[model samples]
Target: MRITGIRATPVAVPYRSPEVWAFGRRRGQVSVLIEVDTDDGVTGLGEAAAYPSADIVLAVLRGLEPLVLGEDPFAVERLVRRIELVGTWHHVKATSPAIAAVEMACWDILGKVCGQPLVNLFGGRFRERVECFYYVARAEPDDVAAEARLATKAGFGTCYLKVGSDDPRTDIERVAALRDGAGPDARLRIDANEAWSPGTAVRLIRELERFDLELMEQPVSGRNLDEMAYVRGRVGVPILANEASWTRYDQLAVIKAGAADVLSVDNQMDGGLANLKRAAGLCEAAGLPVVKHSLGELGVALAAAVHVIASTPNFRYANQAYGALLADDVTSGFGGGLESYADGCMEVPSGPGLGVALDPDRVARYAELYRTEGASFSFGDPQALARAHALPKL
Candidate 1:
């Protein structure tokens, strides 16, 4: 059926605790929910992490709406290509969230039309459930150790520690505590969030080599491929590419440069499932494993990631910052409870489509927040607003 209309609503859901990363603290999660309506009376829902503003949503609608308004929603590839024609050569970080929203919605529509779950549509499940890792913020060594124990007790197989705050000694102590707390069986991973330089990463990795970390993620800045390769060569542990690599094109460069051992794919940042699949395929061809990057997403995208991980044969590592940790998920916030993870594995949603339904009442509540104080359309001062507006839509 043809797409009849596209609508976007931004929402702000406050977090139980401030989400602290290397970047900054997020008091609330801001996202844009996209609804795609088709002629056959079928509607698809998608959400994207709304940053700085809802401009990405506006850009996607302004660019893709005209081309998709009268076209078949099933022609997702053609729609993506048309949008790409107007999109920048390199993936524009600002518009990726919007693209992710639309792409996810389109996948939803396809699943409904096929009368199958998105996972089945991809191929078939290699595994019925996926293992998950806990995302712990940068905190004191004692606090981090406590959190790690909680995650392991909660049935998570892995715990991801956020590093790169200040004081290398403190970071090292935190990692050591987590490792000690997790003991010998549980997997521990560290994410520097591009906080360290090559020298610092080398020094830290050397110091923490005794802990047996599963991997180190984005230890250095993503921009310098050569430096990343250099770090990879010098370090003993497996270095994962998170922000440093995204699409297949980016992975190709990383592989050619021999930059990283693992590729962390985020559906939100990597243009949704289509590009994620491509990147996974590339990683498989290159003998590299795939891991999912967390973006504080809700059930819809989480389901999509489960489908990808289940269908993709090359994915090895469990994704971090997922499942029960997210406080304001539309699905679980309502009545749709998350699948329980037992002994380090979470069962995929068995229902049709993305396997979750949105609570309209909850959506309305958050939508009002977006329209009021939570709406952020520009990042800089007053002058930047005009410049942002002048940028081509999509």
Candidate 2:
């Protein structure tokens, strides 16, 4: 069937709490959702990372629609290549999410046409359900501990702790409380979001060792693999790299440097679901445990992550942040609504494609939010916005 039209909807969903980063709290979560329409009346759903600039992504996606108007949605590679995903001509940083959203929607159309779930299409189910973690945003030390208790009671195998406070002492105090509150068996992982230098990361990690962290993520900057490798060698905790690495290119650089023990891959950052599977294959070859990373994503992206994780063989941890963060989502009608995380694991949506359906009403609500208040970047740390603009010529 020929392609018809493509639309990108901007969504603004409030975080349950101020999503703290660097040293402060963010106002809310803003994302751009993608919809690809075809001539046979088949449609697919997808999402883009909307921080820094959602408007630009929307504009870019709109401009690219004509390139895909008459193509086969099932020709996934050709369609992805039709858009600039890499090299000097690509704008993957600002538009990766937009392109990824479109790519995922194509997969949705492909799956629906073939009558199979995304997990089935991606080489069957490696695991019917994937383990997940509850994310504890930057908050008071006591509040962080309390949230860990609730996550543990809910049966989450691990809980995420975000570290990057201006005061190093606060990080220590918070770690203590979470450890004592969650008990011994519960795994604790911390993400610094590229906030420290190698020396500081070494010092902070050494100090937090008594609590036995699951892994210290992105402790140092993403720019230098050698710095990350230095911290990894000095510390005993397993290190999982995030912001510092994206594609197989970065993954290999980090691996060759012996920078981290684990790799965290996000579908949005890696381009799309197919690229993520390739990154997983890279990890498989390296014998490293790779997990999914969900930073400020909405339901459509989270559901896409679930499908990829379910199909990936090297995914071996309680991966991602979702469910508890967003107050509401723009999709519905999966085996359960996308908010169905329970007992430390989320079952893959058993229906066709991404296994989630978009609710027109909900989409409109978020779409309106974007129209009114979606113009600027407010991801807690302002430097991140600057870093985004500094993306290399490509």
Candidate 3:
């Protein structure tokens, strides 16, 4: 089918718990919704958690539309080579979120065309549902502990916490509270978001070892794989790289350096669903588990992730997509919210495409919000997002 038209609508989705994560101090998410329409009337949908800002995402998408129109949606490789946004847009770098949305829409159209779910393209389904973790954003120790309790109460297999602060001891207290409140059975993991120096990362990892964390994610900068490996060697916890590896080159660098025990994958950041699986395959060859990451994604993006995660073979760790944390979602065909874990696992969508459809009314509302309200996030200063009360050294 020939692509007839491509449309992008900007939206600023509000977060239910905006005050939690330091990276998301702003009260809302600014994203662009993408729709690709073909000559046969088959339409595809995708979500872009646009980086820098939604306006930039819209601008890039508009600029790239002319290149994709009248092209074959199924011809992904040819289409990718045609526009060639690599060095110019940083392919998997600065403009990934924008590139990702358009790419996801192409995959959606391909799935609809083939009359099969995207998971079928990956050699059929491995499992009906994938395990997911309950995400507890960074907050005070008591608040973190309370969220952990809620996660366990919902029968969550894991509780993922965002751990990184100006003070290492504060993170320790947060972990201690999470461990104590979540009980012995619930697994706990922390992501520093590259907030610590290599030396500080090692010291903090060593201190939190007693908590029996499942892993410490991206403790230091991803730019220095050697430093990451050094920290990995010194700590008992498994290290998973998030921001450290976005492209194939980055993943290869991490694998070659043995910087991490687990590799984190994001569909949008890694060039959509197909590329995400490629990254997963590379990690599997190296005997590493692939973990799905969430960064303020909406329902559409979460559905895209589920499709890839369901088809990925070497993914062992649970995924944490904070789609449910958003007050508004474009769709809800994923069965339950992010916290809704049935027996500590989430059911995959068996439907076509990403297994979800865009909610026209909700989409319209947010699209209108984007046009009128601009971006709703405060993303204020990272330090400003932290709690004023500080804990003493343990």
Between candidates 1 and 3, the one scoring higher on lDDT is 3
Over 122-239, each residue of candidate 1 has an lDDT whose tens digit, in order, gives 8889887777777665578888888778777777788888877556787889898898777788888898878888888888898898999889998887878897998999989999
Worst 10 residues of 3 by lDDT: 385-394
The number of the candidate with the highest lDDT is 2
TM-score per candidate: 0.89, 0.92, 0.92
Candidate 1 regions with alpha-carbon error over 4 angstroms: 86-90, 332-340, 372-394
User: Number of clashing pairs, model 3?
Assistant: 2
Q: Residue 106 error for model 1, in Å? A: 1.3
Model 2: CA > 4 A from native: 85-91, 333-339, 375-377, 381-394
TM-score of 2: 0.92
Q: Candidates' lDDT values, in order?
A: 0.75, 0.78, 0.77
RMSD of each: 5.4, 3.9, 3.3
Q: Which has the better lDDT: candidate 2, or candidate 3?
A: 2
Across residues 1-394, which tens digit of lDDT does each residue of candidate 3 receive? Answer: 8889878887767766654543446666677888999998999888888676776777878777777889898888677666665325556355677778878888888888788787787667787788877777678889888888877887787888877665677888999999987999888889887777788888889989999999899888888899899999999999989888777668889999999999888777766677788899999889889888765677778777777888778888888766445566767555235544476676776677777887788878877877777645636755654645222111
Error of 2 at 135 (Å): 0.8
